[model samples]
Target chain A: MADVARLAGVSHQTVSRVVNGHPNVREETVLRVRRAIEELGYHRNSTARALVTRRTNVLGVIAFDTTLFGPAQTLSGIERAAREAGYFLSMVSLDDVSPDGIVAAAEYLVQQSVEGCVAIAPQRSLVDALAALPGPHPLVAVEGGEGSGLPVVCVDQVQGAHDAVRHLLELGHTTVHHIEGDPLWLESEARVVGWRRALEEAGAPAPEPLQGDWSPRSGYALGRSLVARRAEGERVTAIFVGNDQMAIGVLRALHEAGLRVPGDVSVVGFDDVPEAEFLTPSLTTVFQDFAQVGKESLALLLGEIGTERNGSPGPSATERRVVPARLRVRGSSGPPPP
Target chain B: MADVARLAGVSHQTVSRVVNGHPNVREETVLRVRRAIEELGYHRNSTARALVTRRTNVLGVIAFDTTLFGPAQTLSGIERAAREAGYFLSMVSLDDVSPDGIVAAAEYLVQQSVEGCVAIAPQRSLVDALAALPGPHPLVAVEGGEGSGLPVVCVDQVQGAHDAVRHLLELGHTTVHHIEGDPLWLESEARVVGWRRALEEAGAPAPEPLQGDWSPRSGYALGRSLVARRAEGERVTAIFVGNDQMAIGVLRALHEAGLRVPGDVSVVGFDDVPEAEFLTPSLTTVFQDFAQVGKESLALLLGEIGTERNGSPGPSATERRVVPARLRVRGSSGPPPP
Candidate 1:
């Protein structure tokens, strides 16, 4: 520490602050200290630190369906946040999304001596399981929404869903049809609620909801059914989809059916995933700040753990944060065909 | 064990074998025993087992960019394999894929008391770093090819790439353009090698490859440049993209340019991801056995670790296993334009 301090013309306390990832340090000074530390091959030995503090210096993450775009992005965010907080992240994934699955995974992570855990799977049943688990460590939920009795950080899926459906309704279309996400996820249910809410307020009949498993294939299949209905001369002018992948499916189905998006059928999707905008006509979708959700999830967990490394008790009462979703209007959606 | 046997109407040994995930057990018997265990809330206490056997019953995995389809599937594979072997899996993802980064990640895992570790990142430098790290724990590599002084298991990228290019060449194309993946991945370099080799054998020109960072955007960008070259009346007939995500990108760009796929251009992609079949013109891709890779990774690591849990030392002379890759013919690629 002293060697790095002398090399960077900084005091020992400043070097400690930089190494500990203190946010108050000036950016340029942090860079200078980092350079000196790198040149000196100075690494804050986590093992030695663990011995002194009696804490593992490891944080645990419980995520599910990591192959999906949203969960994958959130997991990445949690990892970045943990690293920046000077903690190593250890993760355990559930092959099954059942409550028992969460319980088993939590038990495993808890046994590994994780100082804190961030549960990243957002199904209601999983949240219930998380709430029921006896934890010796602080736990936080991302995308799990509120009412789990644990601190939660999430993008408001309900509002995001509402914005998407309302966009279609406001496009002068009498009714907006929706294809929702997996039933296992609370996000899916929340989206359904938002879609129904928008329709109820507009005095438009909320058509019997269709279910999708969050795959592009499901969207395509469901879109094919809707196309069949359109072939029968039904008024299906506008649609809102649960997520981008399924929307892609719907787009492909509509394309194959010889219908033009936003012309034959105006469409809106959720989670403006990176590929969403680059789709042939591009996508008009809701964008959730998943990265912020992840960062806040970890920060909340650390606060619960009450570590001096990330400063004093994280938020004595800062239990939940709801990140707002933004809508990106792209070429895929517009006024209903005259 | 005795109680479970009595409850399930099976012998004590049968109950033990089933609990341990022995492959020899009959399917029906396995189900019966599992039901009894679940109904009775029987859980294998890993901590107690660790104390009795001096093994942590825990394994470590080091991966990178798991959000990508290939790595994410492999990580899930490893998790499944580990659980089936009655071991808990702890994974640490490297935000950066480099020799130093991998070394640090490995050191962290080693300190966490992992009995064995699976190195899942596929960068050559990472392999080199793994070879250099001192470790008391056993180690194995997946998607990492030979000569790393450690056991390596991987899909034969060279063969896969060669097959993809050869398929294009045999279609009577004069030359094939390649969009390679990230330079940091060994898979990218191997694919490049295979493309060049196939072109050499066919006595055809292999254009200097364009690079992609395995995103749809990069693929779309590279695809647009090709579109421009085609507009200038250059032969841009066949392209072999690095992965399906990029292929989608190229497909979008080409579609926008009014190029008739298979009539004016033929494209082949790697990693037959789930969405490949549903793309506007379905994608033809190389399918690597990531599940096998994951299973063998853990099996090999356990063999190196040498315990009663997973049987013998995997390969006393553990070298490498090259899982074969298959080419899936879909709608995207066809005979080149006359």
Candidate 2:
């Protein structure tokens, strides 16, 4: 930096201002400093700068199961938001969901001097673990359920499920059977709650919900069981699945049994994935705006960071931001059989 | 650190050894140092340690469009491998695929002092840009095409495509129609090459491939076009789509057009996504081992880093690692229109 300043015939402070993009620098002086920097092949060392300014301009993101559609899309949204905000991301994806592992991952980010953290904590256990973390201040949790006493940003999962079930019920289905996702996820629990609430409100009996591991195979197996139940004279007409991938399985299983979608049975799914619209019967699904969730989470975390920097008290534990979910009615859902 | 050493009644060297998990430290001394660290709330400052030792133990990953199944799975695999190797990852996902954007992302990682970098460069432009980067040595490109003079790790896209097309031809199809993915990606290009080569080998006329954006909607549109061609008395008995998502759309289009899969028209797709097996006819597709690609890329990157650290000339620019793709036969492919 000193050599560049000397070569540019400018004060060290002027060179610093030009490098840092300070607005007050004269255009010619800025040009001269940039040329000098280019000529000397001087690249700013963020590590040294972080030490001097106590700022890394790097945020930490803790994610799990990026192979899943929701988490992958959410992570992508967050990455874009972070980049737009001029902050780099230090990412840690947890293969082990143990409490110790979560804590260790957070500590690792802290060691790297991340300014703040946003954890895509979709599981109840993960939210609890993150809530228990002692420090790594200015943390925000995404898709984390309530009562953890942490700032959170998430889609309205319960409402989304309720809307889908209500749509099914309005189409003259006496009740809606749910094929819930992995029970370990808070999303599954919330969707279950919504499904049950919708059924109760409609004065209908709720059958035992089948649990799936959020895989198509599980959905196919569960769908076969439903087919068997219908064969035994059970009234199985409308089905609301936890996610689109599993819905695809259920669609196949129903087809193999010679049952027509929306003719003999109606099916609905969540997570309006890209392929959902082009499914054999075009799935009626709930759309969670993962990009909005990501943006809101980052905004909340940045606000917390600002408060911390200003020496103000942090955000309240119950502080939450909820993005709305919309139901897309498609060919797979319709009136029940006469 | 000094406070921890003083509190533990140990030399600074002993404290350092314990913190670093050196094998030579006495068990009792290690316990004492750990207790001191816990009591003092001492978190090792990696920034300072990096300054002293010039080792950040953080690797950089550059990825684009991770919402896609392949890239998302590949990233998950890399994260698992990096964690197992006890390394932290600094990740940058490029929303802009321009050469300048790629360079800026690389430069950002370099500023953060990453020990090495792994770029998921699947596009021709991306590989060219990365190959042109001045420094940030020990870089490995994943899914990057050949002839860029860079160490590359990718699944055998051409071979995978060849196998899929050959399977259809073996099923007694006179010719196979193609639905290629976005032309900008190297994977799509390789698949196109393989598809053309298979047609030439079989002495069958090669049909001009329809291009899709790797989305179910695009596939649906193109499938409808194929249906129109069939209506005009053209043979449209077989199709090989570039991806499972688009294949889903094609299936819907065919079903709507009253064409039975594997009966009137045989279909195949690449990227056997989780939903592939559960699609209406249970798609026959090529499965790319993304996890293997991730692991191989990281191993290759670590090898480059080791060589760089040892002051070696580094691996040859032509160094390449290829993970094989497998063909999974299922319900979607059979004798065409017999």
Candidate 3:
């Protein structure tokens, strides 16, 4: 510290202030001090410095541990944004959502003195747990409920699902069958609502929906059930799948049953993942910009840390950022054949 | 420190020894000190403790950023193993592999005081960078290598590729075409070797290999080239695709060319990804046990940290740990039509 202070012609206290990222330092003086530190190869040992200023420059992230399209892309986006903003992201997975288990995970980060937390809130259990805790540190939520006095960045799940269902209805299908995610997930519940709303607005009978656990095998099982019903002379000309993986399984089941896509049934899916384009018939699905959600969530957390505000313009401003999804048309969707 | 000392009925110096993870303490004394710290929720605020101990309990990882099957699976496996072993995994992606770029990516982790690093050394440039660095930290290279010295944990890429080709030969294919990854990768070079060795051992002429960038589009382009050659009266009895994504593209291409698999040309792919089973004709491919590799890597690192030894077991040990690959025979492969 003394070497740097002497080299830059600054006092030891001034050097400390510059190194600790104190906002009050003059830009020119901070620049000179940084140059000296770099020249001296003086690594600012974050552990030692954190003791005096109590800021670790570490941002804790709670994310789902899956290779599924949405969460994985969101995590990548968060890493990019967080690194650019000069924060190190330390993550814990919420693959298991028991309150005690989640609490244990959060406690581990809290013990590490994380400056702020950003929970990738995909499930209701996670949201409920975060809501229960009066977090000792600043907190933000991603894909979570708005107006908990905690900032939330979310994709417009209901709107995206509505867009997909509306696309199916516009193709002249009298009714559409739905395969929805586990009801425990907020996205799944919201998507079901969107499908029902689109059907009600069209004055069409709401067919009973098939439930899936978001795995391809689950989708295959439900698809097999649907195929059996079709074999018994029931007609389902269009199906809206909850996600791309399930849509893929449905396509395979229909193919094996001698039904040609678009000619026998039109299929629409959500989360137009990379593989959807490569599927034999191709997939017409809704594309959610998961990377955008990740980027915005990171920006929100940094905004909160710097100014103690969750990136809101004001209380009157929108507390929620709902990124919209776009519908991508491909070979799987078409007007009812003949 | 004072609170912990009072709770443990010891002086501050003893508490310091416990916090530093010194192995000199008696077992009973260590237990007493740990219990006191847990009761007080005292983790020594790693930032503060790191100043003196110089250990961060964090392992930095640099991997390719693609959502491709191999990298994604390896990352997931590493994350699982890391969390189980009480280490934090901080990852950065290298989108390109220029030597300087690889060094910069690694320097980011070095600056964070990661006690060790695991570089996914795939390309020649990355391997060169890894070799050049004067490491003050332990490094375990995973998945690729130029030369073996610094504790490498890798599956037998050449052997995996050989097994795929041998399986096709056993199924009575007189010749098999090869599709390979980018030429820059060590695995690609090794796969080429394995494929050639299989043909030479059988005294069959080496078929010309097709180039791909480990993507479905690249495979589709190469598949089209093969279809054109087939149309010119050249026969392709079988093909060994570099990965399953490319195999899917080749299967689609064959269908479009009116060539039925097995009846026209059998296909074998590497990396039996989740989607392989769901493809129109389920893919027969090579499967690497990434979980075993990940678990082994974590165990190796922990052993290095706990004791001074690297992956080489003590003198008493008779065998080295290596994760092996297996051939999964599925619907896509069969005997060539007579």
Candidate 4:
């Protein structure tokens, strides 16, 4: 840098500024510094250091931000945990959640030498691809349901859903209607299973669940349709929505239709989103510990990939870690339509 | 390669898998390979390749995913753009948005040889840390206001805020009540400035603006306080919230208080988030082109950082690129109550 500075007839600080891409440098001086750098063959030294250490201390993740509450918050948790553990986190978020896209994104990261991976985009095909490859580094699927011959870390969505439905049933609602999440997600299917089980055990008629693509728009449309169905003679009271984002839409749609929550229709949502409590009648919802899920997912992956100085074989066997979920009963759910 | 496999008594594919950290390899096979690697004194070739080429082809970004709509969407846009340009995107997302935290995060990336950096957490001190680096790479501040001495690519928050206020004014509202975003963010400050300008230009009484921490809960509290103030003889007719998330809270607070949107009070919001149009009355808000902002930020950074292959000197003059923002007048805003 000093050589470049001397050659370019500028201070060392100016040379540093030119090299760092500071926008305030004069164009002519920038050009002179570049010429000096080229002549002197100046370059930073991380590459050489990396060659010796063989460790980048970076972890790769593939996640989908689909705007639902869980994925984004979970990502933050993973980031915080990784930083604490002295590893950097980078991700290739799949634009196309298809199997092909998932596999291609993984391959891209593998080439970059990410020590290990935690995939938050949990489509079956993506899970299958991760299972088949298995090594080059460890792979753990967060929220991919039990074992598919690979390590997995998931929130107990079914347990959370069961608790939510049971809460409504305990509140004296004969049967709870449900708005299911995106069909593609395993969490959706698990929630459905939990809700149905609760209904069956209670001997209440479990109506076929309404489907929502996990958007406020879908929730609004579906919620309004449910209200219409109720008006047409079907008894609809308590609703178990897929997530709080959709629950927002449900509350809005119900509000617009002149249905007072917990008075005309009770509502329970999953994912206890930040806005859940601030809704017209605060939502009664299931809370998933997304940060815990993220932290555990990283810990599990690190267990396999091992630490920077110590590369333990890391649990070579397929493993599963289930984080707990709980239900928070707020104003939205109550005795059905007293 | 043949020698290592033969020495380890494993298939060449097995050696490759072992080297890649593929988890399915037998523990015994991994040990055998490790012995062979130690004997051969082998190291990964990517580091060697990096030293030779002087380019990692990886772009580093320090972003704060404080879970707001704009920042997250901007990140997605940046990921897409970087992938298209064949530059792998890695990020250190600061859970702590403090300036000290921001600078330390940048220093961490500098040691990794990221060709360039984008700091989405645009605090003044963070901007200063980036400006002083004057490195062998480049830096750009997305949504960092002008005269930060950094190349800036930002959505026209001022224009967007102005448009939001103007729409309400043109709708014949007496004055628009402003709900400001977090004070630390340049966007928040910019929006406040724009709101004041619009109110002053329209000759409307710019009653002291309400403040929100850019969360629904905060917005709810602030909104409820305003409603209470109005109940105590304060004349409040229209409101412009900082972001869509906060707008949702305000709408909910008003609804619970027996106020009808656009009929009892008018509302407009900034950052027209995805759920904005799906909200109860469909929010009338300022639409920031976040994807465009992301693209322009990367483009500006690349112009300063130059390509990995040519290592050409890029622009030295301070540059500011402002993407356009427009207002989407929806059902939430109408002529104020007579």
Candidate 5:
């Protein structure tokens, strides 16, 4: 601390106030101190700093603001992980993924001098916006890539989708139908690619995918089309939905159309969300380890912050670590009704 | 901005760097300007501030870290409102209501220079923690008390519970059985109180409340006890579950025990989550206006910030606005089975 103060040409008290996040420090002094700290590769153990600085211990997590199962799970997972790691979390939900929102969140964090940050970017807009901002401190992105190049941690959606479709093929199904999530989501696109690759690998027919907005209503509306095909005797025997919620709707549509599940039609969904097992005839779906995603993202962010303190230069090795997803078989899927 | 710089005895460039959220500022100068601004109660119009600041025009949102229906819906509501209000959101989630987490989130927002902030404190921990810290900027709590005496907006859980119980009473049931959420949650406690008050007023048996953790698994476990009681010739003909997820579990348990919904037993749930209407027998539950909760909280926070800028002393008036919850009748609830 004294060395940083010396390098920045400031008193130890001034450094203490800045490190403690007093919010009354001069902007210029903060910049100089930060630069000095970076140049000297000085890192403060917040716990030790708190003893002298009378500071509160906290870690802020910035995530995509949504109730979608993925985001919700990720949020819960991060919170649990943060708690386990001896940090508390403060949350912010953005109305849009704009540059202003990113800057605002960043400024808010700076004012608080949040020890570190984990920003969950499920969409492209947030990633780009965050990438342009100056490296304020240790920032990590969950599922964010492209220009941000920040350390990313995400579930292996492409591999998960591949496994789900491959399961159907192994069951001797000639072809499988797909119900995908919103096209804009990276996971959604990745799943689409995996689905196509699986079908192509086996020389199976790949029908034009059915579009969905990750809602049961969207699935229900699109399910009607599949039902119509069933009535015309040209039905696709197995369906892999983007999520469990939409899968429920598809099941309802099939039931209403007099098609028995796993008998007349087989179904598989992603995100083995809660309630999947309790569905009238439990659902077969892919399970994502969201808790793992949260834990890894935090660890990754902390690592980057630690490295930055060591004066490591030239874009830290930011790479995506994909968590694996598993298939849970139940009543919703089986061999195509012979 | 110039006046603040002059008053604080800092250079114009230093003030610009502070306002623009440049990471290169000194902590001491930052504190001086902040104190001066507070003393002057000076606030910059974000739009004009944006032009000079070169910010991305983004706002950070502290999201409730849960997959529970209410929190998810409220988050989505905030996102939608933010977009309409012409801002973007960067969100963070915490696992538990840890003061450290809340502080971390607040600090993160401060560093980002977020125009303002809203903390969703369904649990008391976050709220109590936020109270201890010096608020860095405009702040509000959703589903939390107007306790901070700051602007507060939320769905009236007390009223919602009252409406649910009253509806059950009006249906000719002697008394409604209650399945309560975790006792620690403020909303849960509020609902429990409302349920108890309604029953006490009607001189009906409150029947030591059955406990649930707001999960289908817990609901299923509790439902088994009810089913066993029925087998022993005791029956709870009508039940009010705390949330839809739990209600689904209760319904499944009863179904497995050969009891028919609204036939052998009547059940009602809260949240009226999207899939509630599609449940096998559908669900009769309470509908909360999540969007209203989000909009009102934002307005309250922004309004409070506005008042602060106008040099008003504290809030003009305490807003204890509780958006009402409605009873949505479906196949789940009915008169006591003959």
Candidate 6:
């Protein structure tokens, strides 16, 4: 530190300010200190600095099932947002979603002295586990549905599903059948609610929704069952799948059954996955701004952290942030069996 | 420590050993200490412990483009392995792939006093930047190709590509066109090498490869272009696409051009994503065991860290570990049109 200060011809405090990214440091002085530090290869020891300043500038992010597209995209969004906010992330991804696992992950982060935590809690169990934790650390949940009394940032899953159903109904379909995602997920439950509500509002019959474990194979299986029902004289004119991956399977099942999409059955999916646009019959689906969800979660977490640091009462526990879901209509949805 | 010792009827050192997970502690003693600690809701301060024992129990992971399937899966695998190994990950995902960005991420991890780092450096620039870092910190590269003298763990991309092409040639394709992934990636380069080599060995002409940015849209666009070449009297009987997402697009393109998969065109892809099997004509693709790659990278990194701690010379810089890729033969690839 002394060598960098001397080389930069700056005072010790000025060098510290520049290194710490203090806003008061002049551009020229910051440049000089940075150049000197680079030339000396002087990397600041964050551990020692953290001890002195009591600020680690590190945030914890607990995620689950990151191999899935939604969780994975949300995590990537959070990483980008954390970096842009000048905070590093200490990430813990739980392969198994259990109460003990959630508590253990939170405890681990607390031990690391992370300023706050953001959990991608999409399942009710995960949200409950996080809400039950006894700690002073600030926490913000992403896609954690209501009633846990924790601040949350989520895409409006119900609204997204409702829109898809409404679009299919307006296309002259009397009713829209749904292939629900894993029943354990809060997202699946919410989408089911939306689909049911839309059907009720339209005075249309609501058939029992088929359950899927959010896999393409499950979708394919359930889709084949729907095809059989159609073969048995049931009206299976339109289908709303829980996610795009499952939707792909549904498309395949319908194709194998010689059912032309929109020509015989209108298919809709959620998650507007990248390949949605190029499917055999381009999919009409819901788009969740996963990155926006991430950004909003970080902003909420930072707010809580700031309140804690300032010794001020934070926002209400029920604070909710909803990133709106958009419906992207394409070739898969059209007039039903004209 | 004193409180836990008193409650557990054990010495402070016994409690310490139990808390630190040290061996040699009696099972009864460990259980007693744990119960006491749980009863008191005791949580160890990792920062202080790190300062005293100089063991942070944290490993740094610098990743890039994690929104993509390959990187995302690899990261998930690494995360699972790290937890099993009892280490927390300080992850930095770079949105931009540049030398300066890589160096900055490395420096950031160093500041956190991470014991070692595993960089998911699949790009040439990333490996170069990591290799250029002037630090004593142990580093391992995951998916970083040969050269640059770094301990690397990666799937055998060349062999995977060779297997895909060989399967096509064995099925009686005269020549197979290629749709390579983003050119800057080492995986893309290596796959192209394997594809070319297989064609060369089979005494087939090597047509120019189309470059796609690993997006389904790019695959759709390139697939249409291939369709055009076929219209112009080119033998576009088979195509080896870079990834499954792109393969989906190509299938749609072929279908639109009245070309039936396996009947008029056979397609193969890499990465064997979960959706591959559920695609219209279940995609024949290469399956990279990302979990194994993650486990191997962590093992290699831990070996380096252990060597550094023991003051022993570490393994050779060019030490390489390759996980074999399996060719999943599905319905998509078959004999070319007669």
Cα lDDT, model 4, residue B142: 86
Model 3: iRMSD? 2.0
- Please provide, for model 6 over B40-101, each residue's C-alpha lDDT reduced to its tens digit, 9 standing for 90 to 100: 98877666677778788889999998888988888988888888898989899887888888
Which tens-of-lDDT digit does each residue in A1-338 have in candidate 3? 89999999999888889977999999999999999998887755666667777877777877765466677778778877877777777777755767776787677678667888888777777777876775535667787765455678888888888888888889888888999976677778778888999899999888899999777777777888899998898888888888988887888888889888989989988898776776677789989998898888877777667665445453322256778888898888877666
Off by over 4 Å in 5: A1-63, A76-141, A144-151, A201-203, A301-318, A335-338, B1-64, B75-119, B123-141, B144-152, B197-205, B298-319
Colliding pairs, model 1: B303-B314
Question: Least lDDT summed over 10 consecutive residues: which range in candidate 4 chain A?
Answer: A306-315
> Candidate 4, which CAPRI tier?
acceptable
Per-model root-mean-square deviation over C-alphas: 8.7, 1.9, 4.7, 9.3, 9.9, 3.0
Give the poorly placed runs of model 3, Cα more than 4 Å off. Answer: A1-42, A145-149, A309-318, B1-44, B307-321
What DockQ would you assign to candidate 5?
0.23
Q: List fnat, each candidate.
A: 0.34, 0.87, 0.31, 0.53, 0.25, 0.86
Better of 3 and 4 by TM-score: 3
Native-to-model Cα distance after best TM-score fit, residue B281 in candidate 4, in Å:
2.8
Give stretches of model 1 more than 4 Å off: A1-54, A307-318, B1-54, B307-318
The global C-alpha lDDT for each of the candidates, from Candidate 1 onward, is: 0.83, 0.91, 0.78, 0.82, 0.76, 0.91
TM-score, structure 1 vs. true: 0.81
Tell me the tens digit of each residue's lDDT in model 6 across A125-236: 9899898887537899999999988999999999999999999999999999999999999999999999999999999999999999999999999999999999999999
Taking chain A of candidate 5, what TM-score results? Answer: 0.79
What TM-score does candidate 5 get on C-alpha atoms? 0.71
**Per-prediction TM-score to the true structure, in the order listed:** 0.81, 0.96, 0.88, 0.85, 0.71, 0.93
Q: What is the fnat of candidate 2?
A: 0.87
Better candidate by lDDT, 1 or 5: 1
**Interface root mean square deviation for model 5, in Å?**
8.9
Docking class of 1: acceptable
Per-candidate interface DockQ score: 0.23, 0.80, 0.42, 0.33, 0.23, 0.76
Candidate 1 chain A: minimum summed lDDT over ten consecutive residues — where? Answer: A43-52
- Scanning candidate 1 chain B in windows of ten residues, the lowest lDDT window is B43-52
